[model samples]
Target: MAPTRQMSRPEESTLDLGEFTLKYRGDALPQPELLVIGKRSGRHKAVHTFVNILDNDGNLVRQAAITPDIASFIFGSFEVRGSTEAFNIYESDLVVGKWSPRTRTNVSPDLVRHQRTIAEQSFTATGGKLAHHWPIFQKLKETGFGSIIRATLTLHQLCSSNCPFCSTILRNKRDSVSLTEAQAFVSTLYNEQAALNRNEFVRYNEEYRRLTGTDIRLKGLILSGGGQPNLWPHFSEFVRWLGELDLDVGLITNGFPPKIAEDVYERFKWVRLSITPESASPFYPDGRFDRQYIPASLRHNDSLTVGLSYVYGPWTDDDMLKRLDASAHENGFRYVRLLTDCNLTRQAQLKAHQDLADRLFRLGFIDEVGKPLSRIFHQLKYHGSQREAEELWSDGQCKLQSYNVFWDTTGHEENGYSHCYPCDSVTVLADEQGETDISVSERRFNADKWGTVKSTEVHRLFTEPLQPFFDPRDICASCLFMNNNRAVSDLVKRASYGDMNLDTSLEHLNFP
Candidate 1:
C-alpha cells in the first residue's frame, strides 16, 4: 500500500466589523492577486461591494465594479458555521487587491469595497481550462496578437533522422543562423528596443497594457527546431548567451545527448525529449530492458524537469510501451506523454490512444478506474487529429495566434529587420513575384501569418493589430491549443461589456 501524502493547511487571519466577522485562509482557495470583499446582509444572505482595482503598492490603476452575479462567481457560495453568523471566507471572497505581507488585511488604495481590478474580477468569473492564461485574455480583448507572452525560436530546419512521421523534415533547406545572428536576436528580445523608435513603441504599447495599466513582457522562450535542434551548429553558444537573460527557457529535441556545456543545459527550465520508437529498439530488443538507453544528463536533475514524449502508432506494441514506461520510471522522468500519430485517420487516432489507456490499465500501470498507480502517463485524450475534416471550433476568432509568436527558418532577416511567422503552423515566404507568401497547411495554416519584427524587437508585434487572414472555422480542422482558444474566446465574450472576468490569480505565471 502507498503512504498517504499529507497537505498542510494554510494559516488563517481574521477581520472584525461589529455585525460580521470575516475569517480568511490564504491557501483555502486559488491564489488571488486582487482582494475580494463579502458582506453579510442576514443569516444566509450575502452582500458584496464592488469598486476600483488597486495595485499592491496602494495605487489606483483602473475602475471596476462587481455585480451580484460576478461577485458569486469570484468568491463562490458562502457556507455558514455554528450560531454566530461568522463566515469562514476564503481569500478569494474579498473585494480588494493582493493582501499586504506586513499586515494580513486586504491592501486597498482607499476603501475595501473598491479593491480588485476589473481584469481581476472578470478573470475569476470564468474558471475555464485556459484559466492559467487569464492574463492573455485581457490583452486579446483588443487584437489577436497583443496577448503574446511567449515566443518559439526555431533556429534550424535540418534533421538527418529517418523518422517516418515527420512533417517538417521534408522542408529542411535553410542553414542554421550564425552564432552572431542568434546572439543578436536574443539580445534584441532582452533589450526591448531594436528597430522600433519611440513613436512606434507608443503607437503599439496601448494594445498590450494590462488592466492595471502595466506593460506585459514576454515571459518564456522555447528553443526548438523545424527539425532536431541538437544538430544546430550554434546550439551551445546561443544557449549559453540565453542563460545571461535569465528567462524561462524550454527545449524540445529528439532524445540524443546534447553536446552542449552542462551549465548551459541545466539553465533550461524544462527539457522535453522525444524518445521515438526507433530510439526504444536498443532498450527492449529480444525482451531485454537496458536502463542505460537513457542518457544520465537527460534524467531529472535538481535544477530542471525532464519528460518523455512518444508517438504511438501501428509500430507501437504492448512490449514497446512497457519498455518505455520502465525506462521513464528508472530515469527519473516526470511523466511519459503518449500521443497518437496525427497521420492516422481520426477514428484510428482516437482508438490508438484509447487502446493505449486500456493496455496501460491491463498492464497495471494504472488502476481499473483509470487512476495512475506506478506510472503517470499523459495520454493525448483531448488531442485532435490532423486528419480531422470537421471543424473542431465554431468560433471565427483564433485569438491564441495573437498570444504567441512562433518564428522559424522560413522567416528571413535583412537590414537589421526581421519578418517572421506568427506560430509554427504559419510561415511567410518570398513569392515568385517577390511578394510575401503565407503557407497554409492543416497544421501550418491554423496560425496566422501576420507582420514583421524589427530585428528581435517584438514590441511592434505585440502592439500591432493582428488581422487574421482566415477564420479558424474555415481553415483550422484541428488544433492542439483549442482549450486556450476557448478560454480566450470565453473571456472576450464576458468582457465584451468592458468588464473583465477570470479565474484565480496566477501571479503573472504567463506562458504559452
Candidate 2:
C-alpha cells in the first residue's frame, strides 16, 4: 500500500463554513477577479430576469439583469438561492432589463445553444463526434431538469489487471478478497447500481425510446470496478452493450493492453491513460511494474481525446521525458496529456530526488516530478470532493473533468485532498468554431460497476448532496484507502497516498 498523505497542518481550508472549509491556496492574492454582466428582460413580456453576482471571495455578490423576450440572470453569477440551486432565479427582488431581440437564424441549434451557454450539447457537427451521433440532425430534443430523470440499463465493467501500477496489488490472495467475498460484494454493488441507473443515469437507446415519452437519455455509465477493469471476465460483453448505446459512453481504466485500448478507442471518443512507468526497480514485478513503456502509434492525429496521467515516486526516472517526447511527436495524441508522480521511498531514496527534479525542470521535464502534477491534471478532469489521490490522479486521479462525473463504490467520507474539477459535466464548453459539449453525471458511490444498482439509498447516506444516490458493496478495497506505506515486492503502492513514514510497522497498514 502507498503512504497515506495527510492534509497539511490539520487545518481545514481557511474558510470553514462549518466542518467543511475552503483551504486558501496560501496565495498572496487571495481574491478572484469579479466580472459583471447585464441581462435583457424587457417590459411587456412575462419573462422575469434574476439578479446575482460573485465577488473576489466565493460569496455571491448581488446584481440584477432583465430583458425582453428572454429573461435570465447574468452568467457565472447568481449561484446562491433558496428552494434549490437550479431554480430560485427570480422568486423575489428580481431585476429586469430591455434590449433588442436577436436571433442567429443561419446557425445550427447546437451553435445557438452554445451562444446561450446551455449546459451541454455534444451532438453538433464539425467540432465533436460525427454529427450523425446523438438525437441530433432532424430535431434535437431537450430534456427539462426534473426531480427524477434518467434510466440506465446497468452492466458490470472490469479492470484488466489484478495488480495495477497505481492501485494496491494486495498482500496476496489471503490479502485480497476471496471469490465468495467478491460475490457478496457484487450483490451489494448491484442493488445500488439499479437505483442510480434508474435515477440520473438515463438511457436514450432504442429500448430507452420504448421506455419513456421524454427524450432525457442516459447521461453517464461506468466500465470499471473495485479492481482492474481488464481482469473483469464480462468486459467484452459490456463493451458490446456500450456500442449499442450509439450515444456517448464513458470508460475509466488503466491503459494496460492495446486490445481494450483499441476497442475503446474505436468506439468511444475519450479515455484516461493512467500509468507511465518510470525507473526500473527490482521491488516491482521484476521491473515489469516499474520499467519504461512505449505506447503504440501516439501520432495518429485522430479525433480521439485522451487524458495522460503520470505518478511520481522517490524512484521516478527519465521515463517521463521519453513519454513526453513521444506525446509531443507529430503523430502524438490530441490530449490534455497529463503527467504527475510520487516518490514513496524513505529519506535515503529522496536524497537524489530534488536534484533530478531540478534537472527535469531545466529540461521542461518538471511535469514528471511529484503529486502537484497529478493534482493539476486530475483537477482538469473530475469534480469529486475527495479527488487528488496522491498529489494527483495520475490518470485514476486523472479523471475526466469534461463530460464526466464521479462515482464511488464505497459510501465513504469525501477524501480531504486538494484537487480541482474542471469538467463540462455541469457547464458547457464551446470552442472558437462554436462547437459545444456538455455532460450531466451523478456522484455515485460503490456503484461504479455495471450489472445492477445495488443500494440506491447509499447515495443519500454519505452526507453528500450528490444526485441519484445509492447503496454500497459489502467488501471494500484497500486500494480505496490507498494509505499504504509498508509496500513489499510487486506491490507498487501509488504515490497519490503520501509520504510513507518508514518508521511504521506493516501491521499499521490497517489491512486484514
Candidate 3:
C-alpha cells in the first residue's frame, strides 16, 4: 500500500491593523523612489510623488533615499476608508495617476478598434467559436503580430500537495507527458513558418503583417503542470530543449529536490515558487525542512531571477505576511506576489482581501517591496473572485475571444476543468498514458484520437467556433476574465473615442 501523506492545518488569522511599522534595513536593500495611492473614498484624492534621484544623463538611479518624513507621510495618506483601495511604490519612474474605482481612463481607441475588428473577424472565421479563440486574438492584438509569443507546457499530472483551492491538485494523477512528444511539439514551434504547412500559421502572419506590417514569432515558454514541474523525469532535458529553441522559459514549482534550482538557473529566465500559509511552515526554522529545498547558492544566483506566489485571504494574517517578507529578503527573492484563493464563492472575502492587500503592498509594511507590482495587484487576478452577471459582459461583447490556445499531454480538447475564461496563450496537454493528444472542448479535454499535429489541424482546432460546444453568451455570464478584459477594453474604447480625461494629479506611469 502507498504511504499516506500528512496534511497541514489551514492558516487562520485576522487582519493585522497596527502592523504599519516600516523600516529600511540598510544600503544593501533597494529603496522606493515613487509612491502611488488610489483613494477609494474619504477625500477622493490621489497622491503620486517622485524622489529626486537621477544621473547626469537624466536616467533614474538607485541612490534615492526615503527620509523618515517622506515615508511617514506616504504611509499615513494610504490609510483611507474605502471599499476599493490600491497603494503601489516604485523604485524608478512614478506611474500612479488619479484612478477611479468606478471609472478608468487609459484605454487606447485604436487598440479597442483593432481588438473589435479581430473579434468580428474571429467570429466570422470560426463560424462562432469566439469563446475558445478570444484569448488567442486578444494576445495577438496585444502584441500586434500573429506569431505565438508564449506557450505553456503542462509537463505532468502528478503533485504532492492537496491544497483545496487548487484546480490542478484536485485533478492530479500519476502520469507525465512523453519526452518524445514534448520534443516533437517544440520542434513544430521551432521550425520556421514557411517550413510548416499549417494554413493558420500562414494566414495569421499574413493578416498580422497586412494590418501592422511586422512579422510574428514565439518568444516565451511557461513550464507548469498539475504537479511540480521539477518532479518530471526529463526536466533538465526539457529545459535544454527549450533553450535550444531560443525561447525565454519560466518555471512554476513547489521548490523541491533542490537540484532543479541550480539546473533552472542555467537555462530558464525566471522561476516562481508557489507557497501557502499552511504549507509555508515547513520551510521555517522549527520545521528543519529548508535543507531539503533550495540552497543558498541557487537563491543568491544574480543571473537567475526568483519570486514567490502566495495565496492570501482572511486566514493569512500579519504574522504570516511578516514571515514571508523576511524569508523573501533573506533568500534573495525579487518579489512576492499575493494571490487570492481560487474558490469562486469567496468573492466578498477576496475583495476585502484585495483592499487590505493594496494597503499592505503600498506601505511596504508587509513583505519586501522593491518594484512596481503586476496589474493583478490593483485588480482581481483570477476568475474565482468574479461576481455579478454584468461583470461577465462587456458592452455586450467578448473582447478577447480567440486570443490564446491551451493543450495537455492527452491531446484531448477539454480537461474537464472550468475557468472564468480561456486565458492561456496556448496549453500543451498529455493523455492518461502520458502521451499527447488533440482535444476539442474548452472547459474539458475531449480527445480526438485521429487528430494530427499538422498546422491545418492546429489552426482548425484553435480557431473552431464556440457556439457548437457551448453558448458563448451563457458561458461568459460567470467568467472572471471577462470583467478584467472589459475594464481594459473599455479604457481603450474610451480613449479612442476621445472620451478619456488625461489630466489628473497623479503623474507617472510604469507597469512592472
Candidate 4:
C-alpha cells in the first residue's frame, strides 16, 4: 500500500497554553465554532493529526462524541480555526486531544484548588524541601537506607519458569534473605526513628497519616525478588512475620504451587501474577500443573485483589489480547497490566506493541478504570510528551537522582545491605567470593555501601545532603523512571506555583 502524502503548506496554532502544536490545511475557520484536532501521520513517518469540529453556530448544535475511528486517524487536512478553549477528550491519557474552539471556557476554581492542594501535600509529605535544598543530591537524600516507604523482601532466588524477558535470568547466583534477616530489617525500620529529629519525625508521621490514613512507620511490605517468592523455603513464616507487624502485604509471583493458594489468599492484601503465553499455555500435553494452577488457585479468593501482568512485544496482537482477556475473566482477575519490554534491543518491538496496546485500549478491550492500568498508560503518555518538551525546556538537571530506594540480597552472611542508586539505572555486581555487591564504579562514587536495617541512614538520607557520588546528567539522561518521576515532580511544582507555562523547567524552585 502507498503511504499518505503530506501537505505542502499547513497553517498552525498552539493549544493548551502551547502544550500541543496544531496544524491544519487551507484557510482558517471562524470563531465560536468547535474544532476537533485528531492525530495523523506527518512527513518522515511522524505522528500528526487533522482538525475538524461540530459547528454549534450552524446546523450541528450538539457536542459530537469522539470515537476510536476518529481518534486513530494518522493525519488529514482541515481549515485552521479561531483561538478558543480546547476540551481534552481522552480516556486514561492514551487518547490525547488537541485544542478545540469552544464557545465558553470551563473553569472550576474548586477543582483547581483541590488539585493544587493534593500536589502540595504530596510534595511536602515526600520530602519536597529536600529536593530544593540540594537539587543535585535530592534523589539520594529522599531514598536513604531505611527511608523507603515500601520495602521489598527477597524471600529466595528461584523460579520454575524460564521466561525470555525476565530480568532475573541475568543474575548468575541464587540466594535469599533468611527469616531472621527479614525480621531484623522490618523491626529496625519500625523502631528506628533516630535518623529524623523528634519534631521532623512527628511532622512527617502526621503528614503520612493525613495522606494514607495510617500511622504506621512504613507503608507496606512487598514480597518480591528476582525469583518466585512462593518458591522460598520459608514463605509461610515470612508472610506470618510480616502480618505480625500489622502492615499490609503484597505478593508478586508466577502463580505456581497451588498448595499455597489459601495461605496467599488469606495473608496477602493484593497479589500480582506475572502471566505470559508460555507459562499459561493451554497445550499442556505433559499435564503440567502450571497451566491450570493460577485459575484454580484464585477461583475462590474473591476478596484478595488479583492483577495480571503481561509484557507485550512484537508477538502480541488482537488475538493474544482476546486470549488474555478471556483468561482474566475466567480466573477472576480484577485487573490487567500490559507493559513494554525495557531492554534497549527491543525498542522497535516495544513500539509495535505500544501502538497495538493503545489501539486495544481505545477499542475498550482492556479495562480503562482499573487501578495501575490506566495510571500506567497516563504516565506513559505524559512522560513521552515531557521528554519531547525537555529538549527545549530542560536545564540538564536529574529529577530522579535519589528519589526511590531498592534493596537486594548482598549474599553477605553478616549483613544485608541496601543499594542506594537511581531506580532507573541499577547495576549490581558480585565480588570474588560471589557475594552480591554494588558495581565497583558505583562503590567508588560512594553510591553503593553497607546499610544495616537499624542504621539511621534513612533519616539522614532524607534530611541531609550526601556527598555526590556520580554526575546526575550522565546517569539519569536516558532513564525512563527518572524521567517519569521528574515529570510528576515538575507537574506538582508547576501546579503549586500556578504557572501557566508548565513546559519550562522548575529545578531551581525550593518549594518553601
Candidate 5:
C-alpha cells in the first residue's frame, strides 16, 4: 500500500463506491478522526465513522475494495508467533478481537452492532469500581496452573483469644511458619523462583500481550490466619521484611498486639481489625475503646484505610451495638463492617444479618438514608431467601479457587509449616468443630488437607494442580465465594466462543 494524493485543504478526500462513498479527513495526532461514509442515494444522511488508518501519518495509503486482504491491511497489525497476522476492529467504542490471518474474514455489520450491545452490557456487569473482576478471564484461560492474583498468608497458628465461634481453632494445634520460612516463601513468589511450564507461560504471555501491550504483574498478599495474625511472635519483623517486596500487602489482625514500628505499620495498603468482645476483652479489659487499635500516627496516614470487622450472631444485641459504635468513634477508625456468624445455618445467617442491619438503622448506627452514618459501613447486603443461597452453591465447581488461595501453617508434623487450602473460608470449615451440617462424615474437618508446601513446592499449588484430600462438592456446604465462582464460570463460558477480549490489564483486578 502507498500514500494517495494529498488534499488541497481540510485534509479530506472521498472514494466513491457504487453503494457508498468513503470520505477520509484529518492529520494523525487527533482522536476520532472522522471518516464520512455516505450512501449513494441523496435521500439518507451521511454516516460518520472514526477510522485510525494503518500508518501513523494518518494518510489513506491506498484506494482498494473491501476485500479480506484489504480488511486485514486496514486493521492494525499485531503479530502472534504461530499465527500469520492479527487485526483489531474499533467499532461503537468497543475494541473487539485479535483476529489471526486464517480468521481475517470480514465481520458483518449486524454482528459488529450486536457485539457493541454485548460489550456495553458486560462493562455494566463488570467495571464497577473494585467489584470489576475482569481478571477472571486470564484466570479462566490459564485453567489450573495459572497466575495467582491474591493470596492469604497465615503468619502463625497462635492466638491470644479463644473466641466462642473460632472455626480454625482445631488447626491451631500445629506449629506456625517461622520467620525464616515465611521470608523464603514470599521471596520465591516475588522472584518467580519456580519455573513455569513452557506452554503455560506462552499462553498466558499471549493473552497479556493482547490486552496490555506490555507486561503487568500484580499479586495481593493478605497477612491473616487460622489463629490471630497479630499474635505471631515475629509479626513486626515479617511485616517489615514484606515492605521490601513488590506485593500489595493487606492486614487482617485482632488489633491487640506487640506494637509494630510506625514505618512498618504504614506499609500495609489496608488494615482490618477484627473486633469482637471475646477477642478484645483479653487484651483491652475495659472494652473496644480501651486502647487505640490502630496507631495514632497512622490515623492521618493518606495511604492507609483502617476498617473494623464485627461478627453479629445469636448473642448480639442493642448493648453490643452501643459498645461497637462508641468504640469506632473513640478510635480513629473509618469503617465498621458487620458480618454474619458463619456457624449459624444459611437461613439463620441471612436473618441474623438482616435483623442486625435493621437494628443498626433503628439504633442510629446506620443513617436513615441506608448508608453508614459517620462510622458504620453499609455491610454486604444479602438478598433473597435460603433457597436462593442453596441454588448458588450448586452452580458449578469453585473456579475462584484457581485465582486466589489460602496459605496456612497446618501441615504434616514431620514437614515444616505447609498447608494450601482452597481459601480461608474452607480452612475455617475444615477446622470447624465436629460434623458440619454440610457433610455427613464427622471427620470432614480433617478431610480437606493439601500436603506440606515444601514437598511439592508452595508456588506450584497455584500454578500446578496437586491432588486434594477432599472434594469441595462433598464437604463444603456453605460457600462464601459462590458468587465469585459463578461469575468466573460465566466469563469462561463466554470467552470460549471468542466474542470479546476481556478488556483487562495484566494487573487489573488482581485481588480476585
Candidate 6:
C-alpha cells in the first residue's frame, strides 16, 4: 500500500518486478522449482509447467518437466537437494518429470526472450502512459475509505472473427463465433442494458459516485466480439446508437468495408482500424478487403480521427511498415498505433518492433519523411531515457497498461488485466472449452495497484465528469504516463537521439 518506492533492502526481502511482487533475499528466495505461468488464473490455467533452473549468474538457465504441485513449490521445491535438474516433481497426484538437469542450459540472448519482453514493455507503457492522465488513484489515496479508482466495465461477449493473431481465437480455438449462444448474448444486452436488475449495477454506480463524487461512465465501447461487429448489418445502428449516448466510441476491425467505417466515423468520429498484413499476407483480399480500396475510401473521408493499428512486430519489414505508415497517414489519420506483440510470444518480432521504434525516436520519433510515429516506443523509450528516470518513478517497475476490456451490453463491470494489459490480478474469461465464465473473485479495479484497467466504464469516465480534465497534450502534466513515459521515452530517444524535449502537448502533439 506504500508508495511504490524502491526498497534499498529489496534483496533482503521483497522483489518487485513491476508486474509481480515477491519476497526474495537476492541469495536465496522462494524460487519455485517448477513454474506454470498460464493465461488465466484459478482452475482455467493450462497445465504448462517447467522446472526452475538457474545458473551461477542468477540467470534462468533451463527448465525440466517436473510438474511440481503448488504445494511442493510452496514447501520444498526450492529447499530440495540432490540436483533439482534430475529430480522428479509430484503433480497431478503423482510424480512427474518433463526433463532432467543434464539437459543443456538453453542460454543465449534468445529472440524469444527479446520479443516477449518488448511486447510486455509496449503494452504496459501504453496503458500506464494513458492512465497517468487521470486523478483516480491520487484521489483515492487521499480519500477516507480506500478509494480505488474503479476501471470496471463488462464487454459484450459476442465476437465471431477468428483472426489467428487474436488471443480470443487461441482461446476459443475457432474460426467463427459459436452461433447459438453468440447471437443470443447480443440480443440480451441491447434491450437488456437498462433491463438488468438495477440492483447490482445501481449499487456499484452509486458507491463509486459518492466516493468520487461522480458516476463511472463506460470507458470505451468496442462493438467487437471475436468476429467483426460491422459484419452484422445492424452494426451501424449499434455504433450510431452508442455515439448518440455522448461517449467516446471505438471499434477495432480488419477493415472489410470502408463504408462501415464511414458510417461509424460519421457517428462516433473516433475509430481504430487494426490490420495485419503479416497474417493477411499479400495485403489485399485477405488484408483490408484490398488495401487500395480501403485507403481510397479513407482518402476522401476527412472527418475521421483514425487510429491506424497494425499487427506489426520486429520481423515486420521496414519497407512494409514504411508503406503501411505512409498509406495510413496519406489516408488522413490523426495518429498511427501499432499492435505490437508485447505479450512476449515471439522474440524476433519484439526486437524488430523495438528497432523500428528506435529509428523513430532517433529522428524525434517522426518518420524520415516527417510524419509522426506517435504510437512508436522509441518515443516511449525516449520517455525513459532521462538520467533521473528512476528517481522520478515511484516503483521503477515496467507494466503493460491495465487490462483489455470490451463492451456491447454488460452494463458496467471490469475484467482485469490480460494479454492486452496487466500481467496479474482478477481476470474474466470463458473457459478453454468456451463453456463458462471463470474469474478471480472480488475483481480488483484499482488501476494503480494493477497498473492498468480494461473496462467500458473507463472510456465514459474520461469523456464525462473527468472530461474537463481531458487534454491531449496538457493532460500530460497530471498523467500517469508522465511518470513512466517521459522517463522511458526520453531514455530510449537519448540513447539514439540526445536529451531534448519537444512539446508533446496535445495540440503540438500531431493528430491526423
Per-model lDDT: 0.46, 0.27, 0.39, 0.39, 0.47, 0.33
Write model 2 residue lDDT over 1-512, tens digit each, in one string.
22122245322112222111122222122211111111111100011122223222212334333221112222211222111121112222233421111221122112110120010112110112211112211111223211111111112222233221222211111112223333333333234433443464345223233432333323334444333454444455555645664344444455545444544445554444444332212122433432323244333536554444444322234555455444534335433233221111111112123333443445553354322221122111111112223333332321111112233223221321111121111111101111011111111121233112222322222122222221111111112212211111012233321332232221101001
TM-score of 3: 0.52
Best by the lDDT measure: 5
Q: TM-score of each candidate?
A: 0.59, 0.34, 0.52, 0.54, 0.62, 0.42
Clashes of each: 21, 81, 54, 12, 1, 72
The root-mean-square deviation over C-alpha atoms between each candidate and the true structure, in angstroms, is 25.0, 23.4, 17.6, 17.7, 28.4, 16.6
1-512, model 4: which lDDT tens digit per residue? 22233334333322221112233322332211112222211111111122123233211122332232332221221112111111112222223433233332222222111111222222122233333322222222343322344456655556565442344333323445667766766665455532342344454455445544544244556676556788877787778767776576777886566556465456777777776544223233343323456544466467666766676543344565666666667667665565544332112222324354455666565343321232122112111223433552254433343333344553432344433333312332111111111111111112343232222244443454433344434333334344345444553343232222321232212221
Q: Which window of ten consecutive residues has the lowest lDDT sum in model 2?
A: 427-436
> Could you tell me the TM-score of candidate 1?
0.59
Ranking by TM-score: 5, 1, 4, 3, 6, 2
lDDT of 1 by residue, 255-339 (tens): 4543555566677777777765442233334424333244556566756667667776434556877877777677787666666
Task: State candidate 6's TM-score.
Answer: 0.42
lDDT of 5 by residue, 1-512 (tens): 22233345544544443322334444423211222222422112122222222222212222222233333333323112100111112231122323222211221222211111221222111222122434335554546444555677876666554443445544534556778877766755545522342244565555554553423233568888756676777888888888876667888877655465667678787777776544223566543334635576557555666667777643355776777767666666656676655544333344345556567778876654445565665344222223433464454345545555566665534365466656666533311121122221111124234322442265765555533334445445455555555666565555353455443432223344
The residue ranges of model 6 lying beyond 4 angstroms of the native Cα positions read: 1-135, 142-164, 173-216, 258-261, 278-283, 286-292, 295-303, 345-350, 358-504, 507-512
Q: With candidate 4 superimposed using the best TM-score fit, by how many Å does residue 314's alpha carbon deviate from the native?
A: 3.9
Backbone-clash count (model 4): 12
Total clashes in model 2, counting residue pairs 3 or more apart in sequence or in different chains: 81
Candidate No. with top TM-score: 5
